[model samples]
Target: MKNSQLYKGSLNTIILKLLEEKGRMYGYEITQKVKEITNGELAITEGALYPALHKLEAEGFLEAEVEKVDNRLRKYYKLTENGQLETANRLSELEEFIRNMQTLVHPKWSY
Candidate 1:
């Protein structure tokens, strides 16, 4: 990410939203998807990605399944029931945050 701090707080939400859309994804796929979606403005690093994935899995928001693809094992993540609900909630909160930031950054004038 060009301004990782700006996006850091929303990483979990971002992951949730992606999994919700893609159904399931492995770690590297998630990283590449984010980069592709953002036209490379955002690059999710393994250092940042795995801990968040582990945290979400521990929190019951995600579940992982490992599969052998070719000769390597790939762990994929998908949203749990709770995760689906949480995605809606988090998306609402993120949208509101963006709207609030927009208001602050580009306020309308009242005469």
Candidate 2:
């Protein structure tokens, strides 16, 4: 498993990107999907996940819906209109950062 610091900075971006791709997702579903996609190399703890989610919701970048499923409430999150735009912007920023990091750290590779 990677260190928390390595994943910490990207948590919000990761969540935004996932929501952008998946439309809407519940918390556990998000955690599982991330683990699946990363082949279990990374995991999102409730400690980290909930705060990021709550912050995004508070910042108007996400909206939530609550539904009763199997005698419990499940809160699902989706991007707002502002969030859709922010997704585009954040994605671009992330991509650009990746490119820059590659240039610095993997300069021998040919893209």
Candidate 3:
């Protein structure tokens, strides 16, 4: 799960889903949550994470707010209205993709 190539394409969708579920989260918090959820199998690196966040923010699918925590500013990301709809759409798409991959990988079971 820590394989970047395998999970890179899904990062945005993952972030969206997480935001939808958790309301809002900072970058570090997001990485920790994902690691915890995956039982340390998956680790999100800051290298991939920040770019995805900036892209989401630029696309208006997410909104960021800065708050002072521990005497330092932290940027927390949340899904916007469009992001909510997009998250639902992306989730559906991912579900279909998963089914398709499963079918291809286990053709006998797909029958």
Which candidate number maximizes lDDT?
1
lDDT by residue for model 1 over 1-111, one digit each (tens)? Answer: 465699999999999999999999999999999999999999889999999999999999999999999999999999999999999999999999999999999999899
Clashes per model (N, Cα, C within 3 A):
0, 0, 0
- Candidate 2 regions exceeding 4 Å error are 108-111
Model 2 lDDT per residue over 9-107, tens place = 899999999999999999999999999999988899888899999999999999999999999999999999999998899889988999999899978
Give the Cα lDDT of each candidate. 0.96, 0.92, 0.94
My TM-score estimates for the predictions, one after another, are: 0.96, 0.92, 0.94
**Predicted candidate 3 versus true structure: per-residue lDDT over 12-108, tens digit per residue:** 9999999999999999999999999999988999999999999999999999999999999999999999999999999999999999999899887
> Best candidate per TM-score, number?
1
Arranged by TM-score, best first:
1, 3, 2
Clashing pairs in 2: none
Worst lDDT run of 10 residues, candidate 3, spans: 102-111
Winner on lDDT (1 vs 3): 1
Pick out the ten consecutive residues of candidate 2 with the lowest summed lDDT.
1-10
TM-score of 3: 0.94
